[model samples]
Target: MSDRAVPATPPPLFDTAVVAGVGLIGGSVALGLRQRFLARRVVGLDASMDVLREAEALGVVDEVRISPGEWLREADLVVLAAPMRALEPLARELAPFLNPAALVTDVGSVKSGIAAEMERLGVRHFVPGHPMAGSERGGVVHARAALLENAVWVLTPTDHTPLTALSRARTLVEHLGAAPVVMPPAAHDDLVATISHLPYLASLALTHMVARDERLSLLAAGGFRDLTRVASGDPRMSRDMIVENKEALRCALERFRRQLERLEADLDEPEELLAAAYEGKRTRDSLPVVKRSLLPQKHDLVVAVPDRPNQIGAVTQALGAEGVNIKDIEVLAIREEGGALRLGLESPEEVQRAAGILTGAGFEVRGRS
Candidate 1:
């Protein structure tokens, strides 16, 4: 969150930060808040007692409470990291309790519905966010501070959203090592419906179709595994995401259906379908390697290093000297000799400079994306 080095001590931005859920996204945000010193006091609210117990034990939150009252009122920043279904009602409860100057944000996938609810509740300082980061696995145990590293965290702010709320949410996104992209609520829903929501449904259909075939286990390979990977994620979360943004998803599904129809019509002319496939490939490949961003998008590079005590710091210091800020550093596959470590930086140029710095310092720099 500072200029370069992971601060030994960081100035807190919020007097109190409250996370309304203790699952993957919520827990990860809580972990980031602590790791980055983004908040002076961190608290969590979850209906699940088991989740609260796990989150507290994991030290993601300083305190955990089942219901909101004083805790909600004390928070300067409140993140509704609960399911999409939970946000509407939760906003209703917090409508009366929130600090007048507090900023409210959410990790819900869809924003239009949330925007509508906030409007209905007269919630002034609300920002809707969706961090395009997470794994197939869910829950607090799997939450990691680096889960958001180099990932996209979108802020969907309508004209009604206060500038202060938007700015605060963006700062939190960057502090967590994620790039923040700003857009309208409807535009975000329409965009993700094609890229995110559609993939989930497609993966679900493919996964189900394969499951019904007894021989699928034998035939399945990397391609099948890759295709159905989205389907393996938490079912309840996927269902909530799908149901919440049904309108945009409906349009996306219809478009996909039309594409299928075109391919079906081309069955008699195999070459036509092949041409269509090639065109699709070209369009997909043309998409920017870096997703669109409001800030300079963070880039990642892997460094192969000797398992020396200060090897990682050596790399960080090298970059720090160049004014290249390392957002995150992850050590991977440590062995007796050396290991691969990933460095996340604020831009593509920083990634290159950091990689060069590490390489010159006698560490092997590999993967960059």
Candidate 2:
């Protein structure tokens, strides 16, 4: 079996889709569905009238509903894209309003608690999902049609879940240009605890520790800011995710603490610390890199460039001179020292050549292929 869910062209997967919250994630899902023509009519059901209006105005949804009862009955695919903590209560309120045949899923970060809540409420068609894509920003204004494109959209289903419901969820994921991976809810929570939740806590801890020191105000720069970017996301949502997966998070914290202790113990051993550092860089470099696509296909090449005039022009000129066509380019991030510039090429073949060209030009290239 393939490790990744195959992306298949989607037909009208559902007659209507009702996104529960029109925030960054929910709005993005609605936008993705509309872009793909996955739903004949897309509806927005959010508690915030302002958000619903904004989403509708942005064309993320075909129509806006003040209440779930207004559109819930007609919705064959319902996306609950609220925060983790609100899901249970939202489910309770939405349970009586759901169509018996409607396939319900969510875009929450943690799945175990949401899955348990779905089971507790006797929701047979519910699938728990966590899209491996987000930003420090929130709200409909920041939402994009390509937000979930080429990203991993994980769906966790129980053994009791009907295959049709599971398939429907997967098809929607594929329609959004995302790879769907199915797993048990508990496993999903455990994995994300280390990779997702723990990282947030670590960033927050770092920020908390460093920010209190007024002496480091001028000292902390590029590397420090880059490492702590996760701590800059919605604080309330981060806290909720951490608390919801505290059991798995506890285990992750213990492992992290042991690593920290080892580093402390090896403070005087320069070779040992250097070995640890190399191991980290090796592991990070081993992972597959997929960029959010602007065109139909994309291969991202991120270059670490100095913050000076003509640097971007020089990068583009190098590509032009090498006969490499640039499909798209973007400024991924900017630090106090330099900026990380991302370029999307047409094919994987262009990636290495571009990296080589930049490396030759004395640019620090991080090939994200």
As a whole number from 0 to 100, the lDDT of residue 251 in candidate 2 is 96
Give one digit per residue, the lDDT tens place, for model 2 in 1-369.
965322222235578888998899998898776654567778888888888878877777889987666458788889998777888888888888889899999999888888888888888999899998898899988887567878998999988788989998887787677889999998998899999889989988888888798787577789989989999989899999899899999999999899999998778898999998999899999987876555443476766666566677878988899999988887643434445566888788888889888887776554421
- Any residue pairs clashing in model 1, and if so which? none
List runs of model 1 lying over 4 Å from the truth: 1-8, 286-369
Residues forming the 10-long window of minimal summed lDDT in candidate 2: 3-12
Which candidate has the highest TM-score of all? 2
How far in Å is the alpha carbon of 272 misplaced in model 2? 3.6
Candidate 1 per-residue lDDT, tens place, 1-369, comes to 644332122246677999998899999899777655567778999999999999988788889999888658889999999877788898888788888789899998998999888877887889989998878888889886668766888999989998988998887787667889999999999999999999999999887887899688788888989888998888888899999889999999999999889889999888998898899899989975643223322477766555456666777878889888878766543444445566777778877777777766666564321
* Candidate 1 lDDT: 0.80
In terms of TM-score, how similar is model 2 to the real structure?
0.76
TM-scores of the models, in the order given? 0.75, 0.76
